[model samples]
Target: MGLLDELESEAQRRKSNDEDASVLKAARETAYRTVLEPAMADLLAYLKELAAKLTELQPKIAIRHSLAGYGDVVAYVEHEFDVREVRQPSSKEITVAFHAAVSSSECPSVQIEGGARVRAVSASFQRHRLGAPLAASKDASGEVVAATFKAKGRIPLTAVFSADAASGQLRLSFSNFDDFATAVKTVAPDQVNEELYDKIGRYLMREPTDLMREVLPENYRSQLRARVHHEEVKRRWESQIVSRQQEDIALLKREYGIGARFNRIGDAMGKLRGLVSRK
Candidate 1:
């Protein structure tokens, strides 16, 4: 009935739900260790080897690129490799994917075309009686940038490697051509830090939801953080409510010589009221 009682009830409800959440969390952690972790390790190892091979082939990168403009325009783009896991609703199959598919953001802008469409008319009289020149222009050049340039070669540059948990199967899928495998070649050892993999592993093992949150867009992540903060604050407030109510009951008992027989605040208050009337 009182604020303290309401808060205590809510806390009890949360405590019950937290038991269910804990079970689910434990199962997810088990799944991560038994299934996802091995796949992730395998994938990371494969990528490391692939990256080393690409680096060894770095010298061949120049052969794939064409020179343009007055000076050599060397463009270096970083390949962003994203990792994510998907769970199929139908079968509840978990699949982890290492995404290296080329995006426009990973491509360099090389402007190779420079020109304009123009129209002009000129007339001159035989005796130089009259001479006139007229000029007009029309736009024709499409805004072609280096990003549009498709990478040539049979090499699988933009590829996705997905591992299925249930079947323990690994699949490879490819998208976008490689104009230059330079990006893959340039991946520094430090850039692919082991710490990142460790963090991912830890998330998958202990907090899978946190891993999902990590990949969320900035705005969405902010919203998630705010919601989580709200829940934490509410939990702390409820705890404080319980503590404050318990302290009040203890103080009342001390002041009124009330026995430990009473439990509820309402009962304590009623007893206090009766004592005051008698006094």
Candidate 2:
């Protein structure tokens, strides 16, 4: 084609592409507004409630370790949760997440003065000493291995919540679960590391059912309780109806004339045999 014709064709192609792009952008925006935003709001509210609960409780784990060369050491490691709030990274996306052990100074940690081997050996006792006293002496003489459980420190835990704008599907993922386990292993001996890791994991996974009782708004909680009660009552009534129907069927079968005929026949036969023997 001529230069002028080619230029005009390219212009039209560009315009078409721009229109398609605009349509996609608008669709994404609508999805984000109608789907992602509402879902994220609920998630953010839940996270905030969880954060408030954790902050108030300030749940702590007691860790203690001992080595052949190094003496026994005890530490009180506390976990603090921090929510990142909602953030829109792109036009079609939103994210909500929380980080455990966000503050170092605020979180309780274990400070040991020993070499890598000594630290590893001592940390093996972490699970055993969980919830024990945190008092420790600072007079030990050895290399220092500080195992802090904070952001960018030992045992960092980050949970991310992501929602797809178009589908409204929510995904929850932990970023550092393996890292958390690895950090525990690094400071603990092989024999006890697994046990310690399992124990710590179980401890961390625990969440009180009533944690949101105080954090959620009163109206929301009342609504939730009412809904739960309604569901429970409905289930109980359904089960009772099924059981009653079954019992009724059984009783009817037992009292039916068919079964009575067999009993009557046996009784008559016995009476006739007794009369004959007397004669």
State each model's C-alpha RMSD to the native.
Answer: 29.3, 18.3
Mark the regions of model 1 whose C-alpha exceeds 4 Å error after superposition: 1-11, 59-74, 77-279
lDDT agreement of model 1 with the native = 0.41
What is the per-residue lDDT of model 2 for residues 71-117, given as tens digits with 9 covering 90 to 100? 43333434456557545554222233333332234434455443564
What TM-score quantifies how close candidate 1 is to the native fold?
0.24
Tens digits of per-residue lDDT, candidate 1, 115-186, equal 311111111111111122122222456432221222211222344444433333333332322222221111
lDDT, residue 174, model 2 = 46
lDDT on C-alpha atoms for all candidate structures: 0.41, 0.49
The deviation in Å at residue 42 for candidate 1 is 0.4
